[model samples]
Target: MPPPNERDPLLEISGLRTHFSTREGTVKAVDGASLTVPRATTVCVVGESGCGKSVTARSVLGLIDHPGKIVAGEIRWHRTDREPLDLAALSPTGPELRSIRGREIAMVFQEPMASLSPMYTVGDQLMEAIRLHKEVTKDEARSMALDLLRRVGIPRPEQRFGAYSFQLSGGMCQRIMIAIALACDPALLIADEPTTALDVTTQARIIDLLRDIQAETGMSMLFITHDLGVVAEIADEVVVMYLGTVVERGGVDEIFHDAKHPYTKALLGSIPRMGAGTRQRLTTIRGNVPHPSDRPSGCPFHPRCGDAVPGLCDVEEPPEVVFGPARSARCVLHAMERSVR
Candidate 1:
C-alpha cells in the first residue's frame, strides 16, 4: 500500500454540478459535489434516494444524457503511467472517453436486467468487451470470457455463456454483469448499488466477490449506495451526501461513531440495531428528500435537520469545516463550534 502523503488519488472530483433542463424547470441534481477515491481504497458515497449519488457516478463516467448536463467542476483522473485527464472536459461520445470508459474505468450498474441486453448472448457481450480493449484473437477472447465467468462464481460457465441475459436468474445476471465489468481489468470500478435488487444472501456473496477481486487486483473503487450497513462493511472512507451535496466525509469509524453533522447523525441512527429489543422501533428521518427543482435555500437539509439553528442554517450556506485530519462537515453548528475552539 502507498503511504498517505505520497499516494496520488486515482480520481478527484471537485465542485461537480450536474443539472437537468426539464420542461418544468431546471433540476439541480448534483450541485457542487466533491470527493476523492484514493488508490486501492474504497470510498462509499451514501445518501437517501434522489440525493444525486448515481448522478455523481454517471458524471464521473461522462454518462449523463440529454437534458442532464455536467455544468461545472473538475473530475481529474490520474491513471498509472499516464497524464492526468479531466473527465469533465471530455466529450461524452468521443473516442477518447469511449476508450477510457470500459478499458480504464468500469461501472457495475444497479440492475443487471436493465443494463444487460437481451438481444445478445452473454458470451458475445463478454467477449466483445474483452476484445474491444485488448489485442486478442476471437478464440482467446472466448477463453478469457469463460475464465471471468468462473471467477465470478457462475455455475456451468460453458452453458451459461450461450444463454441470453433474460434466461438467467437475477443473481446470475448480476454475476455476468460483474464479469463483464472486470473483463478489462480497469484501474477504477464504479459500483452504483450493485446489490440493490438481490436477496440478502446473494448480496453478501456479491460484496465478498468484489472485495476478493479488489484485494487481488489492487484497483480503487467508488461505491455508491443508500445502505449504511454496506458502507460499514466495505468502506475505508465515507462521503455523506444530501440534496446533491456532500454534508460529511471521513473514515467509516468517524462517520458512524462521531458524526458531527445532523444529517449524517440521523442517517446513522436510522439503521436498525441488532441486539435491541423487538419492541424498539427503527428511527427514521422526518421528511422525504426535497425535489431537486424545489430545493430549499441555504443548507438543503435544514428543514429536515433536527438540530438546525433558526437564523443561520436557513439563511446561509455553511462552509465546510475541518473537524480532524481528513474529516469534515458542512453544517453551521460544526462551523461555529470549530470557530469558538
Candidate 2:
C-alpha cells in the first residue's frame, strides 16, 4: 500500500484568478491567490468579507455558479487515494468533479440555513451525501447518519433524524452541515466560517469538534474566517488576504507576532487586548475593502496603507518577498530590503 499523504500538501492553489462577469466588466474575486493546505494540518484563510477567501475555496471544488467562473490558474489536489489532479480544469458539474466533491473534498458552508433545504429532513440530507459516495443499503446509511449526528453533538440522533432543518436551532443546523461534510470522511475539508452564526459557546464547540475530527481522521482543512481569535486558535498556517489577493502568509505565530504586510499588521492591531479597558477602542483599518470594480492601480491596498510611499507604492505593485520557505509578504515595504540584497 502507498504511504499516507500526510507528508505532502493536500491542496495547492497557485495564481488562481476566479472572476465574475458583470454588465459593467469582469470582477476579479480571487486574483493571484496562492496558498497550500498541507495534509493533516489546518490552513486558515483570514480576511474581511469580499477579500475572496470564499471564492478561492469555491474554485477549489469547482462550485462557482453561473456568471462566476475560474478564469485562470491551477488548483492541484494531491489526493491520498489517487494520483494528483488539477481541479481547476475539471468541469463543474461533470461526473469526475462530482465524484471528488464530497468523497475526497467536503465543505461546510458559511450559512447553515442557506445551505440546508426545508423540503428534506436533515437525516435524509446527511444520508444522501453518504449514500452518494458509498454503496450502502438504506439501513446502513441511516445508521451511519445517526452515528454522525451523535459525533457532531446532535442530541437524540434518532429523534432529530426526521426533523426538518427549520426545526433545528442555528447551531444544531451547523452541526448537521458538519455531519454531512464528514459523512464521506473526506481527505480535505473546506470550512467557510462554519461558526459565524453561532453564539460564543457554540462557536468554541464547533472549533473543538473540527480539531478533534481532524486529529482523528488526519484530514487537511482550509478554514476561512475574519476572526483573528479563531485563526489563532485553529490555524497551523495563516493566509492573510486583502482585496482579491493574498498579501501575506506564514505560520500562525509568525502571522500574529511578526506580520510583514501592512494589511496584516492592521488586522492584528484590531484584535482587542486582554488587559485593555473595555471602553478603549480597537485599532481599525482606514478604509473598507475596495469594490471589485474599483480596484486601485499599483497596490490595491495602497489607498489605506499607512506605509505607502508617495510614488513607489501607488505607481508599481510590489513583488512577493520570500523571507523563508514558509513566510512571504506582498508589500512595497520589502522592496528596499530586496534591492539592498
Give the winner by lDDT. Answer: 1
Q: List model 1 lDDT by residue over 99-121, tens digit each.
A: 99998899999999999999999
* TM-score on alpha carbons, each prediction: 0.97, 0.97
List of clashing residue pairs for candidate 2: none
lDDT of each: 0.92, 0.91
Question: Residues 1-341, candidate 2, lDDT per residue (tens digit)?
Answer: 47765657889999999999999998989888999988899999999999999989889998898899888899999865678899999999899999998899999999999999999999999989999999999999999999999999999999999999999999999999999999999989999999888999999999999999998998889999999999999999999998789999999999999989989998888888888888878778997899987789999999998889989898898799999977999987797878887
Error of 1 at 7 (Å): 3.5
Error of 1 at 77 (Å): 0.4
* Candidate 2 TM-score over all chains jointly: 0.97
lDDT: worst 10-residue window of model 1? 1-10
Q: What residue runs in model 2 are displaced by over 4 Å at the alpha carbon? A: 1-5, 279-281
